[model samples]
Target: MRVAVLPCCLFSLAALAGCATGSKTSEVAQVRMVFPVQAPARPQCDAKPLERLALTGQVASQELIDQALHDSRAAHARVMRDDHVADASINPARLNLRVSVDNRIISSSCG
Candidate 1:
């Protein structure tokens, strides 16, 4: 019984050797823009300073994508889409807005 138990313990330890170590930090970033309602010709440069916004806690990627679509849809600026029209109300007025964003993962704390 002792001999059998010794082999089982050794096997378990070997199997878990890799699992005991921590993984390297991963770098990831994403950007999203949304327009729920009509936007001004030149929307005011109203970005909150980094300190004022919440970058941590609980947020999902899909939510951000949905927001980007919604915001782009609502912007009043002319976007270059094939279906776009300059209009008299008879034809639909397609939006012409451009949204670009960048993100980076820095090795910093949330203080």
Candidate 2:
């Protein structure tokens, strides 16, 4: 027991000493925004073509939804399920689809 305890105590002291030595170091946080990164231009979506695929109040399949998104040229798709909060910010290339818990599409619109 004494042999084991001595090694553990020595290791604990060494670990504490290591931590204390590292504390004396200093780091400078520098952020250089030489040129702000620019995002690619997003095209405006046309929900009309997407609405044609709308079988409202019915379950929306992933493939069907994907096709609609492609037709509308929407950059992003927001599917709002029951009790799921969605961001209100509008994106011209985004497609908003309100659905029930079972993936039934309630309403589809492009922002």
Candidate 3:
């Protein structure tokens, strides 16, 4: 009887170990965080035709700004795996992002 029980005990342990190694389903509550970004100040300029030149310059270089934003979003997603990026807004003042992040992993990632 002891020998029979030993086999049963070992089989239970093996089954438990398999369960431990499998993916765990966990509920992650809503996560919210605010990050302040200093918006770049618009260049000081007089209201004249020359302002058109500045505007043109800004428009032409907009691609760089867009690239920067793409990089930022990608980096944020990589760091916060549980949180999905809901929205991103950039005004003259700052960049604000609303992320549906996994609060469970946020603490571990320190984001």
Candidate 4:
């Protein structure tokens, strides 16, 4: 059985060798496959601009908040009282504004 196996392998190798030996040079074949990838949509909901507006320590003016919301590119804006319980849900395209009891803007963020 071992002798038979050896002859079979040698025959296969010789047959393969003959397929390439007659040529001056053997050329290698290369196959390449490319897949198209799509990038995910990213929402711009940064709070830096809103924070800057709040740094004034004054009341959150409607005009200023509106401009900040527009600049932050948030689809919607929600204003919450500092002591009030706000919705804990996340919204990437929404701006959240927390105001103090005296109407001063305390914190600004995006959820």
Best by TM-score: 2
Report lDDT (Cα) of residue 37, candidate 1.
48
Q: Residue 89 in model 4: shift from native, Å?
A: 0.3
What tens digits encode model 1's per-residue C-alpha lDDT throughout 1-111?
A: 999999999999986774554221111111122324465564321213222333323232445423433443432222222233433332122222222222221111110
Each candidate's lDDT (Cα)?
0.34, 0.80, 0.35, 0.77
TM-score for each model: 0.20, 0.57, 0.23, 0.56
Cα lDDT tens digits, model 4, 9-108, are: 9999999898777552433221112444569877768877665554346677888778878878887888899898977899988888788998887777
Order candidates by TM-score, high to low.
Answer: 2, 4, 3, 1
In candidate 3, what residue range of length 10 has the lowest lDDT sum? 102-111
Q: Which residue pairs clash in candidate 2?
A: none
Query: What is the descending lDDT order?
Result: 2, 4, 3, 1
lDDT by residue (1-111, candidate 3, tens digit) is: 999999999999999987766634221121212444568755331223322233222322345334423433323222222345533332332222222232222211111
Q: Indicate the residue-level lDDT of 40 in model 4.
A: 84
lDDT of 2 at 65: 79
Q: In model 1, which regions exceed 4 Å deviation?
A: 22-111
Q: Give a tens-digit lDDT track for model 2, residues 54-86.
A: 558878888877887889988878888866988
Model 2 CA RMSD to the hidden true structure, in angstroms: 12.6
Better of 2 and 4 by TM-score: 2
